[model samples]
Target: KIFEGNGAIAVKLFPSNVNVTTTLALASGKIPWVEIYADPLLNRNVHEIEVESEASKICIKVENLPHPDNPKTSYLAGLSVIQLLKQLSGGTNIVVGT
Candidate 1:
């Protein structure tokens, strides 16, 4: 089954699940249109994002595996946090992406 609603409402209801939307909003300085789906057929967490601007149009889709120790969390999310920490700590001078 799939459920659709406002991302703001979703943030309040499913804080952890919809956190990416919140991060997107903060990064873009705009509240993005969000669609939440509950599909039992999917084994991994999938996120799709579309952005259009006068300069360019962007589309991204990512499917992340669940953490081995925690099914509720995406493994990539934890890795991303670790990477951020390493960057912040000045461990590396090479920054790949913005």
Candidate 2:
């Protein structure tokens, strides 16, 4: 996909695998160039992100394990949602780093 300017473009290519890119774009206000690779030989899903600017560069890599009950959902993904819900409900009353 050729992007003329800046925007998230993963929806058309990989709709089911776009949480990371979408969250990053919304939080950072910078559209990230996204690339998805399918590896049947691997047991987990992998995401690698690299951001470069004139003064700084950031690299992030995440390997998410598949949920035992549901292969379509990642274990970490569900856990994160639960954590977010707990935080929003004020059940923990603890400040956690995002």
TM-score for each predicted model, relative to the true structure: 0.77, 0.77
Model 1: runs farther than 4 Å from truth?
Answer: 1-3, 88-98
TM match of model 1 to true structure: 0.77
> Who wins the lDDT comparison?
1
lDDT score of residue 77 within candidate 2: 84
lDDT string for model 1 (2-97, tens) is 446666777877788888889898998877677888888898999998889899999999899999988889999889988988979799666569
User: Candidate 2 residues 1-98, lDDT tens each?
Assistant: 22222335665666677788788888898777776666788899887878888999988888999999999889998898889888888896665598
* Candidate 2 runs further than 4 Å off: 1-7, 92-98
